[model samples]
Target: MTRVALMVAVMAVAAQIAIPLPFSPIPFTLQVLGVVLAGFLLGPRYGATAMVVYLLVGAVGVPVFANFRGGFDELVGPSGGYLLSYPFAALLAGLAAGAAANSPRGRALAVSFGWGCAALAVIYALGATQLAVVTQLPASVAVAQGVLPFVVFDLVKIGLAAAVATAAAPAIASSRA
Candidate 1:
């Protein structure tokens, strides 16, 4: 519970580190790092739950989204698809992490990388689609604006999230006992 709440707070903090792009409505933020970490550290159920709570908190008018903006409007706005995809992305990452928890370190890392890509795919798909619909842009333009600019940065975030989660896993497990 404490861990879950902590993730929510982490997400809120991360959202503040936003860099708006002139060409796109969506801002680049560290919120994805928090989402990936929540999944890799907390596993699927708790990871997804944490995202849901975070969304609910934001939906209720808490300024937890990027640039300190939040509300039901945020969830249904042009960037809403990205926000909506967090839970599924977290769940996907957490599922792989949980499955590989007891595997060899190299194998676990591989799984993390693979699943992290899948998670990013999910985020991109939903986010781009929604951006297209909400902004009345063509799909290609939406993909160009919403997904292309973030790939390298997001991949780095995934690596960082995986490394931190893997390193802390033993300590986290022991603490649970």
Candidate 2:
């Protein structure tokens, strides 16, 4: 639990470094990658807790969110819903991956990657819905602007996270022996 909290804090701080985009309000961030990795490594409860802590820290004015901007106002702003949904995303990913880990034919990499994709989809769904509601944009436009642009990058992140998680699992299991 402590380890997970520490990892989340570190990731949240890391996410503050943003690559500002040309037109989108969504900047390129390491947060999604971190969230996926948390799910893959920490299991469901810890992963969700980590994400919740991350959100809480940001909400408390830690300036640890994307773009180095964090406050209560940000939590209630246009991007708030996405931020809020992060714990659920991580929880779903972790649950899926954890379930897969119990199967004889399950490869951790494949399972983690698959779950990461699902998590990303959930995030996009929540984000797009909130964006449409807040901005009064059509759903198609919201998806185009908020979701499409990030898909490829997110997939790359998922793949990387899965690989890392897969490679680490045996070591982790062995260490406990």
Candidate 3:
């Protein structure tokens, strides 16, 4: 419960460190780092639970969303899809982390890398779909607007998250033990 609370606060703090994109409604945020880290550290169920809490709190107008904006409007607005995708993304990453945890360190790292890619894919898919639907933009346009610009940065985020989690995994396990 304390971990869950901590993750929620971590994510909210991360959300505040946002850079609004000039051309896209989506902002580049450290939130994804928090999301991926939550998954990598917490495992699937707890990871997803953490994300759900973050979303619900933000949705209820906690000013926890990016740039200190929150509410139903922010949740369903243009950036809505990205916000909505967080739990699923976290779940995917956490499941991978859990699966890899039993393997050797190298194997675990490889799994983290693979899962990072998959998590990013999941975020883009759900986010692009929402962007297209809400903005009435064509699929290609939506992809361009919402996803293309962020691929490299997101992958880097995932990689950094994986590394951080891998380094901390042993201690994390110890604490749980």
Candidate 4:
């Protein structure tokens, strides 16, 4: 519980690093990296809980969301879908990491990386679908606006998350030992 709280706090802080990108409202934030880290560290259930707590905090006007914006209005705004997907993405990533936890080192790394990619895909799919509905745009146009612009950065985030998880697994195991 303490670990989950800590992760939620960390993700809340991470959500504030908004770069305000020129082309899109999404901005270049480190929230996804934090989300992935939470998943890797806490596993699916606790990680998803952390993300939910983070979202709730923001929803209640804690200013813990992207660009330091918060409130119920933010939850229903254009970026709401992306924000809402955080817990699911963390859950998916955690499931992937947990499944790989008992595998060989190489296989574990592959699984972790693959799972990270899968999480990203799920996030984008949800975001694109919601964006299309919210903006009344076609799915392709929504993807072009929401997903295409962020692919490179998201891929980088996945790699970094995988590397961190790979390195930390041994420490986690030894500490348990």
Question: What tens digits encode model 4's per-residue C-alpha lDDT throughout 1-177?
Answer: 898899888887887777886766567788888888788877889889999998898999998888788898877776788888889999999986667787887888788888888888888888777778888888888888889988999889888988898889878667656
Model 1: residue 143 alpha-carbon error in angstroms: 0.2
Clashing pairs in 2: none
TM-score of each: 0.96, 0.90, 0.96, 0.93
- Candidate 2: segments with Cα more than 4 A from true spot: 174-177
- True-structure lDDT of candidate 1: 0.91
**Cα error of candidate 1 at position 56, Å:** 0.4
lDDT of 1 by residue, 7-104 (tens): 99999999999999999999999988999888898888899999999999999999999999989999888999999999999999898767668688
lDDT of 2 at 147: 82
Residue 121, model 3: lDDT of 84
lDDT for residue 11 in candidate 2, whole number 0-100: 76
Query: Model 1: which ten-residue window has the lowest total lDDT?
Result: 96-105
Candidate 3 at residue 79, lDDT?
81
Which portions of model 3 show Cα errors greater than 4 Å?
none
List runs of model 1 lying over 4 Å from the truth: none
Measured on C-alpha atoms, candidate 3 has an lDDT of 0.87
Best by lDDT: 1
Steric collisions counted per model: 0, 0, 0, 0
List per-prediction Cα lDDT, in the order shown. Answer: 0.91, 0.79, 0.87, 0.83
